[model samples]
Target: MLVGDRGSVSAELVIAIPLVLFMLLAIVQFALWSHATHIAQAAAAQGLAACRAQDGTAADGQASAQQLLDELGRGPLTDTNVSANRTADSASIQITGMASMVIPLLHLPVHAEAAGPVERFVPDLAGGR
Candidate 1:
């Protein structure tokens, strides 16, 4: 009569492999999310820069952002929306989109916004009496 545990290691490996794979998938998803966020932020910054430049327009900002996304955001971002707004003193750009799903059936939202004052010459104030 032999009493021994022969399938313990194999069973453990079988159970642990899937868990490890899931963890790896989660890590990949997080990396994708981070990359998407950085791309969005960069796009927003570029748009803001365009809009805040001298003689810049909101349309120009929007176009700049859209171009960046179209060029660099192929696999990681989808359904992108770019908006640019300019006030009397400031300009802002916003990029919004959905991040690619690394996990099955999961969708993540990503957004980035950048704002700055429009560049203009301010005359030096002379001596006040």
Candidate 2:
């Protein structure tokens, strides 16, 4: 090794190790955020389906969403909020949560919304009056 370049390897390692670790952690964090978002979307869809049913209520939607979150959002997703709204013509469900952090001090938010027309029996479509 040259006298002046003797410590170059050590210096390079010092910079490279943390950079590599950070990149790896960033990839893992992205994955966690994606998974959390999927969970939130699934919960929202479940609640929306429940609330849009013929006899479904907003409370039913909220309960359904909260149950799903309890099952799946306990780890990858945290601090979840579930909301449902049902009106005469439409029903909607919203789920929001923070993705579990893999990188220190990095918090990612995940949100999902599902909405559809409320189910109803139509005499014209059902061939009955």
Candidate 3:
């Protein structure tokens, strides 16, 4: 091989390595964002389940969501918030947070919501015979 040919491979590698690393970092970042979204959705479902139970309160739902975040979501979610709303026949839960940052300049948002009918028994409308 000629002296000029010896340096060509080195030059190509030097240019390509950074691009490959960047791609890997981007993939890892996407995975982190996806995982964070799933965690948020699961937390919202847990809260909704609590609120939909008989005699459940909005506070119970909020607490359940927060507890799930505390126990299972440490690195993937930040600035977590949980909210619950309940009506006479239905209940809902919402969760919001920011996904952990893998790149210093990029930010990803995460959100999830769930709803269900409140458990209750209704008497028959027809008059008893």
Candidate 4:
């Protein structure tokens, strides 16, 4: 080891250690965000199915989404809001929330939406048309 560079390793570690730790935390934070997003999407799709059924109501859609969140989202997802709407020809559901925080002051938001034409029976029109 050169006498002029005797303390270089110590200097490098001072910078390298924090950088490595930050990278690891970033990876963990991203994983948590992804998991939270999937949970929201599943809940939204389930609620959309309930809302799009021929006999389903808007309340049913919201309830289903809330229930799914309660069952699956314990820590990763937080401050969730579920909304549902049905019109004459269509139905929709939205799930929105924040992912659990890992990096301080870094709040990640998660959102999911599901929509489809209302389920209904229609007579064959091929012959008529």
On lDDT, the leading prediction is 4
Cα lDDT tens digits, model 4, 48-113, are 999989899899999999999999998999999999999979999999999999999999999999
- TM-scores for all predictions: 0.90, 0.94, 0.89, 0.92
Which one wins by TM-score: 1 or 3?
Answer: 1
Q: Supply the TM-score for candidate 1.
A: 0.90
Ranking by TM-score: 2, 4, 1, 3
Minimal lDDT window, size 10, model 3:
120-129
User: Where does candidate 1 clash, by residue pair?
Assistant: none
| Model 4: residue 79 alpha-carbon error in angstroms | 0.4
Question: What ranges in model 2 sit over 4 Å off?
Answer: 125-129
Count steric clashes of candidate 1: 0
TM-score of 3: 0.89
Instruction: After superposing candidate 1 on the true structure, give the runs of residues whose Cα lies further than 4 Å from its correct spot.
Output: 124-129
User: Tens digits of per-residue lDDT for model 3 on 72-107?
Assistant: 889998889999999999999989999999978889
Judging by TM-score against the true structure, name the best candidate.
2
Ranking according to lDDT, highest score first: 4, 2, 3, 1
**Least accurate 10 contiguous residues by lDDT in model 2:** 120-129
Candidate scoring better on TM-score of 3 and 4: 4
State residue 85's C-alpha deviation in candidate 3, in Å.
Answer: 0.8
lDDT of 4 at 4: 100
- lDDT score for residue 60 of model 4: 95
What are the lDDT scores of the predictions, listed in order? 0.92, 0.94, 0.93, 0.95
Identify the runs in model 3 with alpha carbons over 4 angstroms from their true place: 124-129
Q: What is the C-alpha RMSD of each candidate to the true structure, in Å?
A: 2.6, 1.9, 2.2, 2.1
